[model samples]
Target chain A: MRIERELMRGAGPVAVLKLLERHEMYGYELIDALSKRSEGVLALGQSTLYPMLYNMEAKGLIESTERAAPSGRERRYYRLTRTGHAQLAQQTEQWVAISRAMLALGILPGPTTTQEALA
Target chain B: MTTTAPQHESPPAPQRLWSDILTTPVGDLLRGRIGARCRPRPRDLIATCGLPAELASLVWEVVRRTRLWSTEKVAVSRELIAHFEDGLAVGTSAAELGVSFGDPAQAAALIRRAKRRNRPLIWKAAKLAENAVAAVLSLALLLYTIQVVRLYSHAPNITRNYVSEWNQDALTVPPAERAWPVYLAAMQATNGYWEHNWHGDELSPGSSSWPDITEFINSNGRALELYRQAAAMPKIGLVLGREPDVDYMVNNAGQPIKNAGAAPDPNPEFISVLLPPLTTFRSVSGMLKVDVYLAAQAGDAQRTQHNLDAVFGIVAHAREVRLMLADLVALTIAGDACRTIGALLRANPQLFDDHQLAQIAHRLAGLGGPEGLRTRFASERATVEDFLQRYFTDDGHGDGLGRPELLARLAVFTSGDPAPTRWTPTIGLNTVLMPAISPFMAGKREMLAKCLDFFGRYEAEAATPLWQRSPTTVDDEFIQFRTSLRNEVRYAPLMILMPSLGRAGLMYEYFAQQRDATTAALALALYHRQHGSWPQSLNELVPQLLPQVPPDRYDGQPLKYCLVDGHPLLYSIGVNRKDDGGRLPSPPPDGTKTPLAELNRQARRWQPAPTAQRGAGAAMEKPLPDGDWLLWPPVE
Candidate 1:
C-alpha cells in the first residue's frame, strides 16, 4: 500500500538522502531506484519529487549540478552534502526507535530475530 | 512494460493563452529581473525527442503556470520530460504518467514557492520593499482623504468684533474736549512742506538747510498756533470712523477707506481695522523741533517752551494709540525733542533764566518716565488673538484647526497688492489643495499658546535693564524661535501676525538715554547759571536743580562727568560697556570731533556686531571700536 501524504512528506527526503548517500543520481534515476527498492510504497510523482529536490538544495541538505549523460542528453544530478549525511544518520535512528516501540506495543509484528527487526 | 501512443487528454487553447500573457512587456520585464542569473537559453530537448504532442504540451503547460524565472522553468521542464521519458522506457503508459503528475496548478505553485526561496538575497529584499511602498502610499491616501473631509466641514466662528472693542475708549470721548480735530487742522495748515524739504537734520540757524527752514517757519505760523492750541487740550479724543475726514481717517485708519459712501462697520474684523499711521505725528513733531530751534535762536525762551510742549503733546498723542510701533514713534519724537533741547542749551546758554532752565529740565526728565521706556505688548497680543480667530475655526474650547481660505485672504490683505477681483483656475486649484494640507498645520490653541509664550518671554526680558539683560537676548531669541523648519510649518500664522519688537526695545533704550542726558545737561546749565561755574560733579546738581542723577542706560552706571578744557564734559560708557575716560569716538580725519547731532545720527544707526570667539582665534580678529557716547558740551 502507498504511504499517506503526511508520512511520505517525512519519509521522502530521508529516502532521497539515503539513495544519494550511496552515489549521485539524476532525477529519473532516483525515481526509478526508489520505486523498485521500496516496492512502489515510497514512490513519488515527478511533480512532488522535483520541488522536494529544489527545497532540499535550497536548504543545503543536497546540491545539484548539470551534466551530459552517456546518451548525450543534459541531465541534473543531485548528491548528499555534509549536512544531508548528518540529517540521514539522525533520521535513520529515529525510524529504528519508532519501529521498536511499535513492536513492543504489538502494533507491529514481532521480529523473528532482533537482528531482523533492526535491519 | 510497454509504451503506448500519447493520449491527447487536455485542451491546447488555454495553455497557449497563458503563454501569451507571460510574454507581455511588463511580464517580460519582471521575468527578466527574476531570471537575471538564468543566462544562455537552455535547449528544449523534449521537443527534439520523439515525444507525443500530448506529453510535450503537458510539460509546457506546467512550466508556463509556474511563472518562475525562465531558467528555472527550463530546468523544471527538462527534468519532468526526462522523468516521463524514463517512465515510458520502464513500460509505464503515457496516460498513467499524466495521472501520476497530478494537478498542473498545484505543481506549479509548489515549484514556484520552493524556487523563490532559492532566489538571491537582493531580489528578496527588493520584492519586500516594493510591497512596503505600496502599503505606505495606500495609508497616506486614506489619511489625506480623512483630513480633506475634516477641514471642509469646519469654519471659523468670529464671535467678538475686536476693532470696535479697541475703539471703545476713543469713541466715548466728548467731541468738545477732543484735540484730534485741532491736530487734523494743524496737519492740513502745515502744508506738508517740511516733509518734502527736510532731510532729517536739526533745522537750527547753523544748518545748511536753514534757508528752507526760515521759509517753513514763516509760512506755517497759523499751523504752529493750532498745534499749540491742540497740545494744550486735555484729551486727544481720536475715534475711528466717527467722521469721513480724509486726513483724520488716514492718520487713524492707516489707509483711506475704500468705500467712503458707507459708514465704517461698527463691528469690523480686527485685522481690517487700521492702526493710525505715525508718519503724520512724526512729521508734526519734526516741524515743532524746527519751531523750538528758531525760538531758541531768537533767545525767546517762552516760544521755545511752547514749541517744546507741542512736541511732548504729539509724543503723548502717539502713545495713546497703544501699539508697539506707535510707542516706538513716541520715544523717537521724545528723543528728537531732547536733542533739540540739548542743542539749544549748548548754543544759546543765556537764552533761558534759572526758572526757565529748571522747567525745561523737569519736562525733559519726565519725557520717558519709568513706565514710558517699557514697550507695551498688550495691543500686539490682541492683534494676534484677533488674527488667530479669523484664521482658524473655534470649537469653543479655544482649540481648532487652521482655515486656509482665511489664511489666503490674510495673505492678499497684508501683501499690499490688490487681490484678483475674479476667481481663475489657479485660485480654484489653491482652494481645493489648501484644505487638504492645512490639517497638518498648527491648530488655534497651540498657535495662541506659542505666540503668548514668545511675547511673555520677550516682555519679561524687555522689563529688565539693558545692563542686566543677556547680550544676545530678544532679537537672537526671535530669530532662533521663528526660523526653525518645524516652527515655520506649525506656527505660520503667528509668524505672519507678530511684528519684530526686539529692535523696538533697543530703540526705546537709546531714546531713554537721550532723554536722561538732556535732563542732566539742563540741570547742569541751571547750576552753572546759579554758581557761575560748572559743578565739581553731577552729584552737586541732584535734589537742587535735579531730583536724582540719571544713570547711563548703556551700563547702568552714573553718567560719566569731568571738566575738560575747564568746560563740563558729560558722556556715557557706550555699547562696548567700557569706560574710555569720557573720550569720544575718534574724530574725523580733519581732527574735528563729530557734531553731537551727527553723533546722535550715528548712535541711532548703530547695530551690535557679531560676538567674537572666546579663544585664540579672537586675538587675530579685528575688534569693534570702543567709544564713549558724549552727551554734554554737545560734542561740537
Candidate 2:
C-alpha cells in the first residue's frame, strides 16, 4: 500500500540526503535506489522526487552538476553537503527511536522478533 | 481491507491557466538572459540524446503541455527526454517509460511551486524600492499643484497688503483732484522739459536749455515756487489713483496726454502720475544748480554752501521715501552742486570756513550708504510679484483681461501696444500645464534674494579686496542656477515682462562705487582745507574729517588717495580692481560721444522690446569697467 503524503513529507529530504551520502546520484538513480532500499515502502513518483530534490538543492542541503553519465548522456547529478550529512544522522536516530517505541507498543515487530513473526 | 492500490478508476484531469510568467530558470537567471547561450539550445537537446521520431514528438508534446517559461521549458524537456532514453536502454517501452515518471500536469504544478520558493531576496527588495520611488514622485507632484493653485487664489491681495503696510499713499496723487486736466498737462510738460535738458552736464542758464527750462522758470515762477514748496514738504503724501485704463489721464484741453517724445504715447501712463513728485525734486535740484552757479559767478561761497545744503536735504527725503531712481537723480544733482563748491574754493582759495567743510563731508557720508538702491530693488520685486499675480488671475471678466488696474500704477513702456502683455491661460497648454511650470518662480525668487543680499554685503564690506568681494562669484552661481532652472521648464512668457531681473543687480554695484567716490572726495577736500596741504594718505583725514577712510566699493579697500602735483587725487580701483597707481583707465569709446545721462537713459529704455534679451552684455553680471570713476576735485 502507498504511504499517506503527510507520513512521507518529514522523512523525504533525510532519505534523499542519506542516499546521496552514499554516492552522487542523478534523479532516476535516486528514485530507483530509494524504492529498492526501502523495499517499495518509500517509493516516490518522478514528479514528486525531482521537485523535492530541487527544493533541497535550493536550500543548499544538496548541490547539482551536469556531467555525462555511463550511458554517454548528459544528466544532473546531486550530492549531499556537510550540512546534509549532519541532518541525515539526526533523522536516522529519530527514526530508530520511533521504531523502538512502535515495537514496544507491538505496532512494529522488533529486529529479532520480525524474523520469528514471519516464520 | 482493500490494499491492491484501490483497483484504479480513470478520472478526468484538472486544468489550470498555463501562465509562463514565473518560469525563469536558474541558468537563464545566472547568464542574465542576454548571455543565455550557456543554456541548452534545442539543437543541444536533440544531439545529446538521439531519440526516435515518436519519442522526439512526445518530448515536444510534454513541453507544450507544461506552463513553464520558454527557457525553463527547454531545460525541463532536454533533461526529461534524456531520462526517457535511459529508461529505453533498460528495455522499457517508450509509452510505459513516459507513464512511469508520472503525469506531466502534476510535474508542472510541482515545478511551479518549487520555483516560487527559489526566488532571490534581492529581486524582492528591488521591487519594494521601485514602488517606494513611485509613491514619492506622485506625492511631490500633488504638492506642487496645490502650491500653484494657492498662489493664483491669493495673488490679488499681495499688492494691496504691501501698499498698506509700506504706506505708499504718500507717493501718489489725491483722489479728489485725480481727473483734473491742468495737473496732467503740467506733469507732461514737466517730463517733456526735463527729458529735453537732462542730457547736458552743465546746468547753467545759457547751457543745456537756454530758452526752454530757464525761460519757463523765469516766466512761470509760480510753477517753480510750487515745486520749492513741495520739496520742503515733510512727506511725499500723493494719493495713487487706481483707475482702470491708460485713458484715465487727460490734458487741460481734455485731450489724452501722450508721453514725452514725438507721438502722444500712453505706455508710461502709470508712471506719468508718479513722475510729478520726481519733477518737484528735479525742480528743487535745478534751482540749487542755478543758485550754486550764480553764487560762484559772484565768488560767494556762503550762498553756494547754503544752496548745496538744501540739495542734500531733498536727497535725504528722496532716500527716506525709498524712491531709488529719484534718489539717484537727487544724488547726481548733489554731485553737480559739490563740484560747484570745489570750483568756488579753487577760484578763490580759503573762501570757506573749516566748519562749512566739515558739514559738507558729513552730508556726503549720509548719501554714501547702499540702502536706497537696496530698497529700490526690493520695490521692483514687490511690483513684479504684483504684476504676475494679476496676470495669472485675469479670469476674463469686465475687470480681467481687458482692464487691469495695476497698470494704472506700475508703468511698462515699449514701442508697441501693451495689449499682448495680458497672459491668458490657453486651452490645452497653460491652464493644465502651469501647475507644473509655476514652481520655477520660487527658484527665480531665491536668485533675486541673492541679488539683494549681494547689495547688502557690498555695502557692509565696501573696503574688502576684489578677490574677496562676492559679485562675480555670486553672478557665476546665479547663471548656473538660472540655466538649470530654465532647463527644468520653459518660463519664457513671465521672463518677457521682467527680462531685466537678472541684470538689475549690477545697478547696485554702479551706485555703490559712485557714492563711495563722492564721499571719499569730499573728505579729501575737507582734509586739504584744514591741513593747508593734501593729506599724504587717507588715514590723515580720520577722527575729525572722516570717521574712517571710505572704502573703494570695487576693490573693497580704502579709496586710493595720492597727491600728484600738490593736488589730492582720489579714485576707486574700477572694475579691474587693480590700482593703476591712481592713473585712471581710458574711458569707453562711447563715453566721450554720449553724455553720462544720455547713456544712462539709453540703458533705462524699457530693455529689448520684451521679446529679446534686455542687453547684449546682459549675461555679464560682473562689474563693467567704466574707468576709475575718478574724484579729482574738479581741477583748480
Candidate 3:
C-alpha cells in the first residue's frame, strides 16, 4: 500500500531509474529485486513494469536485449547505459538537496524505529 | 509469470451472458426462487399453437416470465429434462399449479441436451485440437461442422463471461440440433441426385466425340446439380461464391481440350479416402455428438475469438474448400492428361525424334519449381502436336487435312470453328503468370505474389502526373480505367459463380435498419400468438418467422433484445455503440455491418434493397441435397 502511495507520488519513475542504475535486468528480475529490496513492500506488477520498461527503453534512457538465456528462457534484460547513469546522478543530487532542506526546517519525521526489512 | 498461452481456445458462449440476461425482466423469472422450472397461471398463457417451434420458445418465455433470457433453447430443454427426470414440476402446489396440458413429470418433452454419455465418446476427440495427431478426424469433423452448424461474428464483450456461466450447466447442446435430421435429409437428397445422375451417363476419359457431350451432360451437369444441392444443406457449409461463373464457363474451358497426346488424369487421389460401408451416419453423428460435448466443456472453461473464428472459418472453408479441391483436381487432371498423351506418341514410329516428348518432360518437372500453381503449357504442347502432325502426314496417315490446316482443323473439333475451345490452363512452365505448384502446394501463394506486384505498379501509376488509362481532370467528375475484356476474365468458372443472393441482401439491408416498425410489430405478433403472450427473445420465433436466428455481425453475438407485455424487441447497438434498433447507424463501427433484426412488423413498405436481400427469418432457406454444402439459388 505504501509503495502504491509512493507510486502515486511519482516515486515509481524514480525507483525504476534507480533500479536501472544498479544493473541491466529483465522485468521478472526487476520485479524480484524490487520485492526483495523493499522486503516485498514494493508491490509492482508485471503489467506496470512492462509498460514502464517499454517507455524507458523507447526514450533511450536505458538499453535492453531481448534474447534467450542459456537456460532457454527468453528474457529481455535491461542495461544501464551511460545516459541512464547520468540521469540517475542528476536525480540523486536533487533528492539530496531536498532532504537537506527538509531537515533544516525540522519538517522531516524521525527515522522509522524498525530494521530495513529487506526480503 | 508463466503465460499459459494455449494454442487453441474453446468456442464462444454468447447465450451465457448471464449479467446481460439478468438485466432483462425474463432473467429474473428464469433465475428467480420460483426455480428453473416455474409455474405460471393460465391467465398468462396466450395459445398460438400453429407455430410449434415458436410456441416452444414462448413456453420458455411464460416459464421464465422475462422477455429476454440469454439461455439457448437447448439449455432450457436440458433444464426441463433434468427437472422432469427428478420428478419435479414447475408448480409449487396443486392450488398454485394446474396441469392444463399434463403432469410435468409425465409430460412428453424432447430433451434439447446431448445424451449424457457421461463417458468420453472418443478420448482422442476430447484432446486439445492444437496438434496434428487428429488431422484426418478433425478434417472430417471440420467438414461435418460446415454442413449444419454455422459460426457467426459474435459480441466479444460477453464471450469470456458467457462461456464461463454456460459451462456450469449440466447439459449442453449436442453436436447437431434437434431439427438437424430433417435438414440433413434435404441435403442428402441433393447429393444423391448428383451421384445418381453421374451414374446414369456412362462416360469415361478419352472415349469418343459424343462421349464428351455425354460426359458434359453427365459429369458437368452432375457438378451443376451438386452445386444446386449445396443450398439445401445446413447452415454449416453455406458457401458464398464470388460473382461471374457463367462467363468463365461460356468462354474459358476449364478442362484440357487440346493435349499433345499426353495430359494428366482429372481425378485427384486421396490415399486415406477409403471408408467402410459400415460407417453409418449415426456413427459419424455419435462421434460429432461427443465432439460437441467436448467443445461445450471447452466453452465452459474458456472463450476466445480465435476459437469461434476457427469454428466458423472451418465451417466456411469446408464449403468454399471445394474451390481449393477444384484447383487440386485441375492440376492432377491436367498433369495426367498430358502424361497419357505423351506416352501414346512414344509408342509410335520415329515422330520428330524422342526429343519432342523429352523437351516437354523438362517443363513438367517444374511442377515443384518455386511457384505453387502450374498453369499454361503452350510450347511443349505445341511442339508435341507439331511432331505428331508431321509423322501422320509423312507416313501417309494424315486425314487429307494438311499439318497447319489439320492443327487448325483439330482446334475446331475440340473448341469449335474460329474460337478455339481447347485452350490450355496456364501451367507453370510456359506462362510466367501461373506459378509452379510443387514448391507451394497452397494455392494463394501465387495470387498473393501477383497482388504484391500489382500493388507496387499501381502505386507508381497513381503517382503519375496524369492518368494513363484515360484522362480525368480534377475539375471533371468522371471515371477512368474501364475493365478490359481479357482483364475482366476470371480463370475458374466455379470461383466466379454466385447465385442470386439478391433479395436476401435486400432483406438484410432492411433488417439492418432498426426503425422498421412493421418488422418489429410482426415479430411481436408472432411472439404473442405463440407464447400466449409476448415472447421474450428472437429465438422464440426462429423456425416460425425467420428460417434461422441470425447472429450479430458486429461482435458476432446474438442480437440484443428486451420484452414487453406482448412483444419482444430486437435491436443491435449500431456502429456508434448506441442502440439504433434497426435504423441508420452512424459512422458505422469498423467492421460491424449487422443486418440487425427488428420487430418483424416495423419494415418500411418501399425501401429498395441495396444488394441482394438476405433478411433474417423464414423468408426462404435455399434447399439442399442429402448431406451437402449450402448453396444459394443459382444466379441468372
Candidate 4:
C-alpha cells in the first residue's frame, strides 16, 4: 500500500504525459485509457485532471490544441511536448526500480507454500 | 413512484459534517462536499447574488445530501468532504447512516439532499436548477423561450426595506445654528415690502433664493443633530422651492401698504403671503421596463382608438416640436438615463419608430418609476413662521411733521440712482394682483403692478400629487399620474433624489475621470501630506482637488462628498429624480442602493480582508448610485 501511494502520487503527471506522448487525448478519453492500462488501480478525478493538464501546459511541459467533440462541444486535446516525454521517461525508470524492491520481499513463514510466487 | 437509479452505494450520515459547516459560509462548505468528483467549473466567482439567498444554499444542500445517501458511508474520503465533522460525530453519525443502507455512501447523500430540500425555499431552488437542466436537455423547449426561469430574482421587498431603513429621518427638520436665519431675514424684508407698497411703489425679491436653501439647513436642524448624535443616519436632503418665501406689495416708502383696518389693502392687494414649502419646485423622473403582448388588445376601445388615431395624425403632419419619437430620445438624454435604453434601441430597429410606439415606450419607461417629489404637506416648515412684531410711533403726517409722497419717501430708504443697487423704502400700495403670480417667480418681477400680484397668494394647499405631476397644473392628469406612481412604487421618498442628482453628479464623475489620475495622485499626496491621517471628505481637498467644485447642472445645487482612505466620494441629492441610488450624506450599513459601506460589504461578503474596501464601484455590475459615487483606489 505504501509502495502504491508512492508510485501513484507522482505517477499522475508522468502517466498523463505518457498517454500524450504518442497522440493528443481529451480528458474523458485520457481517463478511460489510463483506467484500461492500470486495470482500475488508479482512479483520478476528472475535475482535478484539467487544472493539472492546464498547469503543465502553462509550464511548457505539454502543448494543447482545441478540438470539437462529436457533439460539437469544445474540448482541449492535450499532447506531450518534447520536455513532457523526457520527464515521463525519467519518472518511469525511477518508479520501476523502487517497485521491484517492494514486491521482492518474501513472507518468512506462511501456511501457504513459500516456493509459490505470491499472486 | 418516481424512479431514481441508484448510481452508487449509499453514503454514511453527514450530520456531523453539516453541523460543523453551520458556522462557516454555507456556499463554501457545500462546495467542498458536493463539488468533488464533478466537472470543475467556476462556482463562487460569477455566482449570481440575486434575490432569495436560499437558492445558493439549496444547491449546496442537494449536493451534500447526494453524497451522504451514497454507499460510501464511513469509507467516504476526507478529500471529498469540504467541512470537518467534530470528533464525536466521526464515529456515530456515519454509523447511523451506514446501518440504514447496505451501501452507506449512497443512502447518506440522498437523505441529505431530500432533508435539506424539505422547505418551500428549496423547492423553488430545485425548480431553478431543473429549468436550466431542461434547457440543455430539450432543445425544442429552449427554442421558443422568451424568458427562462431563474433562481435569482430582483425583489421589491429587499430594495424597499433598504430604502426605508435609510430614510428613517427623511422628514425630520434639523435645528439651525442661528435659529432659522433665512426666516428671520425674510420677515425683515417683508417690512420693507409693506411700507413701499402703500406709496404706490413695487418690490422685487433680490437674492432671496440663497436664503431659500436655509430651510434645508433649518427645517431639519434638530433631526440632523439627532442623527449626528446617534451617528446612525445617512444624508437626506430637503428642497426649499429655490425661490423667495414671501411676496408683497409696498408703498412709496418701500413698505407694504396695509389698509387702515390693518388687513390686506384691496386697491392693489398689498400683503405678504408665504408660498407652499419649496420641495414642490423639483423636477420629475421615469424608469425603464417592458411588457410583451400577443396582440394589440385595446384596454378601452374608445381611448385606444383615439390614441391610435392621434399617433397617426402626429406622424402624418408633425410640425416643429410636434412631439415625435425623437423627443423621447431627447427626454431620456435630458433625464440622463439614456445609456441602457439607448444601447438597446441602437441594437434593433424593426421593433419601433412610430408615434404610438414612442408613447408606449415612454409609458413603459415609467414602469415601476420613482415619485416626482418628496416632503409634501410641509405646512409646518420653519420658513412659514407666524411671529410678527408691530410698532406704531408717529405717522409724520400733518401734525407739522414733514411728509412726502409714499413712493418718494420709501425711495429715500432704498433707492439712490435711476437704477438703485441697495434697499429702498419707496414702493407701491397695490397688493390685489398677487394670486396671478407664479410663486417661483415672485422674487423676479420689476413692475409696480406685478408686485401687487405676487403678494396675493399665501394659503395655497400642496397636498401631495401624483408621482409625475404636482404643484397643481391646469391639467390634473399629471397630479393623478404622480399619485398613481407613488401608490405603485410603495417605497420611501428617498428615490425622488436621484435624477437631478443624475445630472449634477457629472461634476464628480468629471473629477474622477480627470486626466491626471490627477485626483488619485492628489489624494495619495494629501493622504501622505496629512502625516498618514485620513480626511473626512473631498471638501478638504477642494482647492486641492480642483480650482472649485461646480454646482449641479440640472438645478444649480452644490455637490456633497466624503473620503475613505485617500479617495473621495461625490454625491448630490437629485431634485425629485430617482437616480442617486439612494446615496445620502450619511447612509447606514444595511441600506439599499449600495451606499459606500454596503458596497464594501458586497465586495467582501465571502472573505473578510483589509483591502476589501468600497469605491463608486470596482466594476460595471457594481455601479454606485449617481450622486453616491466614489473614486476607485484610495490615493497614497
RMSD to truth, every model:
5.7, 12.4, 43.5, 35.8
Q: Which ten contiguous residues of candidate 3 chain B have the minimum total lDDT? A: B627-636
Please list the residue runs of candidate 4 whose C-alpha ends up more than 4 Å from where it truly belongs after superposition: A1-6, A103-119, B1-636
* Each prediction's DockQ against the real complex: 0.60, 0.48, 0.00, 0.01
* Clashing residue pair totals per candidate (backbone < 3 A): 0, 6, 100, 118
Residue B260 miss distance in model 3 (angstroms): 24
For model 2, the DockQ equals 0.48
TM-score of chain A of each: 0.90, 0.86, 0.75, 0.73
Candidate with best lDDT: 1
What 10-residue stretch in candidate 1 chain B is worst by lDDT?
Answer: B607-616
Instruction: For candidate 1, write residues B1-636 as lDDT tens digits.
Output: 223433434434434467557666578678665544344322244455555677777786777688886778778877777777777777877877777777777888898889888889998999999989989988878877777676667777887777667667777779888888787667666644556567566455677888778787778899889988887786677665443445454344344444456777766655555544466677778777887877877878899898888888877777776767778888888877777788788888898888877777777666545577467887788888887787677777888777756556645655755464444225466567666657657888888888898789778766766666765766677788788988777777777778777777777777777777888888888888779999998899878877788887766778888888888878777765567777755545577767755653443333343342131236774443356777766654
Which residue pairs clash in candidate 1? none
What does the lDDT read for residue B23 in candidate 3?
A: 44
In candidate 2, stretches whose alpha carbon ends up further than 4 angstroms from where it belongs are A1-11, A21-48, A55-119, B1-69, B78-160, B168-184, B190-234, B238-317, B323-333, B340-632
Local distance difference test, each candidate? 0.73, 0.54, 0.33, 0.32
Residue pairs in collision within model 2: B172-B238, B172-B239, B173-B239, B463-B556, B463-B557, B464-B556
Candidate 1 local distance difference test against the native: 0.73
If ranked by DockQ, best first, what sequence of candidates would result? 1, 2, 4, 3
- Candidate 3: how many backbone clashes? 100
Query: What does candidate 4's lDDT look like per residue over B54-93, in tens digits?
Result: 2223323334444432222211222112111211123423
Off by over 4 Å in 3: A1-119, B1-449, B452-559, B564-569, B573-579, B582-636
Q: Rank the models by TM-score, top first.
A: 1, 2, 4, 3
Interface C-alpha RMSD per candidate, 1 decimal: 1.3, 1.4, 25.3, 16.0
